[model samples]
Target: MPASRNKKNLQVQRSDHTTIWYTVSGPAEGPTLVLIHGWACNRGDFDAVTDHLPANYRVLAIDLAEHGESRSTRDVWTMEEFARDVAAVLEAESVDTAVVAGHSLGGAVAVEVGRLLPDNVSHVVALDSLTYLSLFPAQSQEQTAAMVHMFREDFAAGVRGLVEGGSPAGFDSALKNSYFEKMVAVRQPAGLRSIEGLVHWDMDAALRETKQPITVFAVRAFATQEAIDRYGDRFDIVLVDLGSHHFPVEAPEGTAKLLASVTTE
Candidate 1:
């Protein structure tokens, strides 16, 4: 059981013409765990979590289409599309039952997957994510539409604002600037459309229907109070004390511990 970082496996091509790149590691007889990264993040985002996992458990991490090495899709990407892409990844790997772990946008997709693939999915974990997109309050159609337009076209600027100047978390200024650069560099029309699609997706039906055991971790000092408060008893909440919005990068070990705890039950 040595650290296995460079063991990438395959590219999963889904029905919508979106090719998802993924990696599988761990043991042959171990439990299967699927890790899904947030918007604009690739599978390598989970390197820390995967490294922390037991050598006896199988883990799969995939780059959502339009992010990382995966190709963009023809369809307007919604959370459902993202969830389906994940389900396809698990099935392709011959994983009959698994613990699904997601972060940020992937957390939302994990909810959809728990609802859609209940039988095969054993449990779910959402780290540093909100249960619903409505956590960010809005005033009118004008504001929502404006936000959507920004996310659809000028998303790099939007993400830049999240990390630039004022919003810098407890993290180092240099690290914050570096992440902002990477997130902004991944922008595209398809990525923008996907962000807008996620913004508009109604999660009421899925959240209410989700009965799986869920774990939600938040960096409140990074994410606002509104984001953490939304989980409540609806999910098993674990708040990490760091202020980095980019928890996967700034605190991968702590993130992995919380994720592994969700499977302990």
Candidate 2:
């Protein structure tokens, strides 16, 4: 994996003992790009992607609360709370303008971040996120209960289900196992609570409040036409033949180019 050059690791302390660990690189005055990783993943996943990004662009790869080196004792795990974690970073760094990009669950956070900082975030990007109607939309009472029960009954199995859902047909078994292992290892209560928060998230409400232009880079094999028809008017959904849901890791250069396309414009 290619490593980003001149990377500096930093942390911001938020209320309730929450600490967000992030990496910053490139000139401080350059156009800003904030990279948020998906659930159960960390900022390190974007190390290669950052390496491939334009050298003059300022990049910040963040590990959301309790996901990586960042630790939190807070009880709230809602997407809005997660967005505050990113906001804290922006406030700490004094970033006035930025293109916020997130992968999977991070995509949801990106939307919330845009809502929270209406003036600061110029655009929102979702890497293989938001298009999944099953996951993105808020579920009914019964649906939310059942989904939460499924994960509560057997957490590892729930994690496995997510991994399987993201892996398209003929995906490498060893690779799948790698993802499973890494995801299943996510810190305890936060791991389970975050899933609950995601299923309960009101993406439509967030979209309505967020005024920024949104773009989604979806996996060609996994994206459903139904999703396109539903969100096409709202999001600029572009399909790509990336490896899997975790394509940012599999195809960093391509991911960087896609992100650059948005930031450069």
Each prediction's TM-score versus the true structure: 0.88, 0.98
lDDT of 1 by residue, 19-89 (tens): 87888888756888889987776787887778877777788888887888888646668787888888888
Roughly what TM-score does model 1 have, to 2 decimal places? Answer: 0.88
Error of 2 at 215 (Å): 0.2
The 0-to-1 C-alpha lDDT of every candidate, in the order given, reads 0.73, 0.95
Report model 2's TM-score to 2 decimal places: 0.98
After superposition, which runs of candidate 1 have C-alpha atoms over 4 Å from their true positions?
131-140, 164-170, 222-230
Give, for candidate 2, the lowest lDDT window spanning 10 residues: 1-10
Candidate 2 global lDDT:
0.95
